[model samples]
Target: MPRLLTRVKSKMSIFAHRKARGMLDGEYGSVFKGRSLDFEDLRAYIPGDEVRDIDWKASARHGSPLIKRYVAVRRQTVLLITDTGRNMAASSLGGEEKKDVAVMALGVVGYLAQRHGDVVGMVCGDGTASRSWPAKAGEAHLERLLRDVNDGTALTSPRSSIVEQLSYVARNYGQRMLLFVVADEVVPDAGMERLLRRLRAQHEILWLTVRDAQLAGPGVPGSANSGPEDRYDVADTRFLPGRLAASEAVIRAYAAAQEQRDGGREAALRRLGIAHVHAGSSHDVVPAVFTLMERHRRGK
Candidate 1:
């Protein structure tokens, strides 16, 4: 587990440098602008400075507009909310387990937080049972948190709902936190959407959806196999009848349904002001996370 975390950190280091440069150049956006928790100093108002941050008394005394500058809080909390359901145990097209991809994703975020001096925590569950680690700083604590979740010792049930973890955080974890939710390709349904909305209202939410190639439609270009003889099931391993898989009309309908489901999930997240990225395999996790961060920084 430590070795995997080290590799993920090495890869993320390059991306982190790029992101830091982007933030300084105003290329990324306001994603990291207002997270400070301590007042640093006052300065003459800049054109792009948020008006709400103006120090009224200081401005009056100086006879010019001034802005309150706050130092970036180094001890903020980063929470990894992961789903350990059976679906997440499925294999990806890259031949790596979805669970492994999730761990890699977690490591990328965890390492970044550690570098920023942020306390890292996790809430891992299988719907029926869940385990949570309080926010803590240090590499060793972070490694233990990751190992515990990756080992599946904390997941008490095979059937887990990501919504359950979201609800748990919303109810119990009150501090404003940066939350990274790692889960399988299940789209948000009405119930899940409601839970996510509540959670987003209180925390910064970033979602990573690990894609399952099997969910690709028959007509999808570059899909694993669209051939008539190809056999595939949903990410959850739900089988479609042989006739359905072979029928052109049924294949088209299935593809359309999946598209609609995916679209709805994206729309819901956007409406709730949550950022999300999709990863197709373990190899895609790090890049996808970087992309997600860039988009959020750009306020996309």
Candidate 2:
């Protein structure tokens, strides 16, 4: 496959001109400001910065307020978390493969972390297996991580299990780091809630959910608003009869169930102080990331 990170940066350059690009770095920096240690330097304060971080004596000497930068904040380990399985190989709500969207989203955040002077790593797996890579600096390392996500995910892969990956990190890793998670729509459960509470106590978490293709409606499962009549299921490799999902009542029920699923996930994450966002396709990743970091920085 072509270089995945190259595609990611090109899109970043395009998004850079769109206003949100420049703000991403500052937003990212602000998110970790509270975790900083050992004073490094100072920069002009922005509106949203916490008042406690300002150096009043320094501000008296200088014309404007300056925010203290810290060594720990400048060299954070950003752990990339994702689910690579049959679920990811399926199509997204934007009519593209979920794996492709995941790669893009992961690459975007990884690139941002790299630019912010942080090391990027990954933890991903299916229901039965999990894998991880150490955090390291450089575009080359970030490229390899993105490539792993792109190449490993397939329709024939094992079932997706983000919980198992979280468990893996909880069991082994002790460092407090930022966890940028990319996964498909997940319904909240008691076990999941327990696991998230545990992880939040150890690491900061950000979740991005790739919107699954909508079935049981007029549109195709993966397509945004249009597609063939039938929906395909990867697990059993069976085609869903269009007549079954074509009913109006069936469509309403499916939509309601999906909403509940979304709300459940949102509430669970919020209760644990984790920030979550939704990306329907590649087009949504950039803005979704911006919104995620904003919420994180503002504690919303």
Candidate 3:
């Protein structure tokens, strides 16, 4: 666990530096971007400068348009809402367990929050049971939070509904926060969508989907198209049959369904004004997160 923590921190350092540079250049956007600002100086107004920031009196005195400049006052709250259900325990296309990728994703965001002097917290659950750690700052607190997520996921049962866990978050945590929902490839149903909508009204939401190998579709190495003899197991406990042969029709149907499911999920989140990142494997997690942050910063 310590080694994992160290590795995550090392990777996050590069991201943090990139973020810092982006913030300085006004190239990054997200709730993590400090909102509170302290007046720094005045400068000649550029064409695209906000009219609200224009100092009319100063501009009159200087006989030219001028705008106020302020340095961002840094402080924020980031909450990592993780799904520790059995599905997350499955292997991803990139060969690592989804659970491990989740931890690494959480670590990246949490470490970045800490570096920016923000409090980091978590709500982790495996459909049946959920655990939450209060927001706190400092490396020690972040480490403890990671350890708790690791321990909690290890002991929890798999068949838990991520919706229930998210419902818990919507009801319990009231204050406005930057919330990141990290989970497997399950698309939200109508009820789950409603809950997410309600939560979205109160917090800035980001959704990270950790893609599973079984769901990555036909072309992936272990996917149905890999061979006619290949068999795939559906990761849930429902009456949905577990194993399926790699018949051409089955593979094509599975790939189409998976694509539709993933597309629908992304579209729903987009409609709700939630930013999202898709990490296909452990190696993709950090880069995916960085890209999301960068896109948000650019207001895309």
Candidate 4:
């Protein structure tokens, strides 16, 4: 095969595999099927109850067991807010750019929501106020929604606060909504705190940080040592754990300090009753969304 053709084929294969895997896991896009109350399971027939939910064949073998199932309830609206500030556009992570990760994560979450029959909307931009699309369900809506995210990221300039934007979204949404914010881990300004506290009174919020691996830890994944011959290697240059490695314990200690700061901010948010999750460069957005969703679902 021609070299270009071979590369294209390889890329196509990877895409196909990823799409298939996502579908198998019941994650295709943002629309999620709401839970229903109809019973779904069945066990061996039991005693002292209604005779409706029994497995006769299994009961025959065991002589007296039973099974039952319930309807799953429908899902509520899911709004994904992403920070496209310059901080996110640049990456300290060794993999994709932080903004790229944010886009992909939003796409995956939107796709899952589309699949599940839930309305998925987005609020995007670098500042407090962003371009908003009201929550809507369906494949077409998801495509349009993702387009906003992709386009919005390019339009956002460096901004220091997200609070103004968050507050605007909170008012527009009004009712309880599942909110997720994909952004960098930079310290929020005072405005951010005020907006978050205000939103706390009305919305369920989750903050997911789409950060680089170097930010998450101190090393690169799947990369070999750098040498004179590899001067141009992106891998060699991308991982800056050296900033920590060179100082020996000091840098590591500093990293720990930063982590503590990050933790404290996160803890403070939680105290106000917000949920937060960190996404590393290597982490796929789909699974992360599901993990957060499952946690929220189970909690309720």
Candidate 5:
């Protein structure tokens, strides 16, 4: 195994150890809810036994009918779509860098989905599909998805539109599913429409945008007075004093603009009978995923 994989395994072992002892059980909750549907039990069959579940060998040995009992299917499939583009690198928040935040958010949601007896799948998007695996349940499957989600290549690519990739995945899946999308809030209206439309038609979609708090609120108390420090031109990487105040104002303006854009997108999605949720630091991530999953459950 690679050194990084060993490190990940070591950390995971610690987490699993803690979980086994019930120390982290309350925080992570229970990943298993009773028995899985994949198991089966054998029993003697009587009249009107299910022909499909007949145990021929047992029936012959006992000179009586035999049947097979199966557990109920307990898992659902989930697909997560993450955008890793140049725009994601923009970090206005002091938290882990934007890319790191995005990856962590994906991991939290993916991990939770797996815990709930759900098969987790991922499509790391960066102009093109970086890696995609069919939804599957179990620790090994979750680990592979995590490895792919954490890879450096997942976030590197030329500017690529999400519309095309969203369409491809939606069209390819024959069954309905729940999809989680992580991306910057500001995307072209046309791109948003195409992507949302495809998801609405075939699956339940949740859109989560990760951005800096400063971008979320520019009118806060100290925010207005600290103005000049925020103004930096990306093109020139040069700072403009006093203008930092104006820069804060511009950031606020852009935020509002994006908000309005998102509002319009929400309305459009609702028209298509799709639900939407907008999450920021105020809600953290676990709650947001729960909210989205609850919404999906209700929709069904």
Candidate 6:
């Protein structure tokens, strides 16, 4: 309802002011400044330095730890991808709607692309359909992208299938761009893996998985208090017996399965050479994104 991009910028500004104390030491600016960067010099390691940037051999020689610095070069076209489906309207592990976190993550990355003089575009939909917008540079366009995700995602919407959207990108867009994908935990399949491989060969891919709410638990937001009266299926709003879900055995099994699902997703992305991260709420988006960016750059 209100201006969404402004909220995105506010988060970015928070990260910006933390630059000096941030992992990249303000080099966070270079996270979206295209792909490649020329090697610069090393600086003394700080408390928050990213371990990936540590020149291990150099550190050993220097007798202490050091962080590698680089000057970013070139620009990038960022394509924000997500699934606007009933699943996203459901709650995230962090107790907020998955769609809300998806929007925030998309907005953060899109704004970063904009700040670095890059154009941003989008591809979103569900199991039944897909849609896209042309790449453009402007806060207005980014706002529209965020709104598209926020407005389209609803409990009554179609089922989610991120594979469908990725397939669309592979078929329609030939240009090489940074694909920033945000979606809820999805069951990985061979078809999805194949599509990811195809897209990986054509463009650089980054994935942000929005953690799902705990189904059977005591500590989760909707677990103990919600009882059987409040819980319902996101797909069709069918009431689920919370008593069954609250069982200790059910909770343990659910947790184990979710862990495996998360691991499988991460394994798939890594095996395909794509950088991936997961976020449970808006607060986790920026840092998760930074981690994703760092992984993407290191792969490059």
User: Which 10 successive residues of model 6 have the least lDDT summed?
Assistant: 25-34
Off by over 4 Å in 2: 39-73, 221-228, 235-238
Better of 1 and 2 by TM-score: 2
User: Residues 112-212, candidate 4, lDDT per residue (tens digit)?
Assistant: 55556667877776654577788898766766665555455532365624564586686777766767777776555566777788876766666777654
Number of the candidate with higher TM-score, 2 or 3? 2
Candidate 2 is scored at a TM of: 0.86
Residue-wise C-alpha lDDT for candidate 2, range 1-300, written one tens digit per residue:
679998888877777899844687888887786674678899999999889999988988998999987676458989999999888998888878998899999999999999889999999988888999999999999988988888899988998888889889998789889999898888769998998898888788889999988777777543454533778876457787777678888889999998899888888888888888999889888889989999998787
Output the TM-score of candidate 4.
0.62
Using lDDT as the yardstick, the better of models 1 and 6 is: 6
In order, what lDDT does every prediction score?
A: 0.73, 0.86, 0.73, 0.58, 0.57, 0.82
User: Tens-digit lDDT track for model 5 on 3-83?
Assistant: 333343344445555344533323323222222335577887778865867878888987887787877566766787776
Better of 1 and 4 by TM-score: 1
Q: Which of the numbered candidates is closest to the native, going by highest TM-score?
A: 2
Error of 1 at 80 (Å): 0.4
Which portions of model 3 miss their true places by more than 4 Å? 13-30, 33-47, 51-73, 154-156, 215-234, 238-244
Per-residue lDDT of candidate 1, residues 166-282 (tens digit): 888877988888898998766777888888888877777888887764533342334464554444443344656555676778768767887887898789888878888888776
Q: Give a tens-digit lDDT track for model 3, residues 1-300.
A: 355678787775666576555452232235544344679999999998789999999999999999999886566678988877677766677757677888888888887777667788888887677888889998778777767666655423566467867888987998778888888887878888899999988887777888877532233454444543332333644332233444556668878898899999988887787878888776677778877776565555
Which residue pairs clash within candidate 6? none
Task: Give candidate 5's TM-score.
Answer: 0.61
Q: Candidates sorted by TM-score, descending order?
A: 2, 1, 6, 3, 4, 5
Candidates sorted on lDDT, descending: 2, 6, 1, 3, 4, 5
Better model by lDDT, 3 or 6?
A: 6
TM-score of each: 0.81, 0.86, 0.78, 0.62, 0.61, 0.81
lDDT at position 88, candidate 6: 95
Per-residue alpha-carbon lDDT of candidate 6 for residues 1-300, written as tens digits (9 for 90 to 100): 679998887887787676555453233354444345579999999997778899999999999999899876555688999999899999988889999899999998887778678789999999898999999999999998899899899888988888888888998998878898998888668888888888888787788999887766654564455553435667656765678677888779988998899888877778899888899988888888888878876773
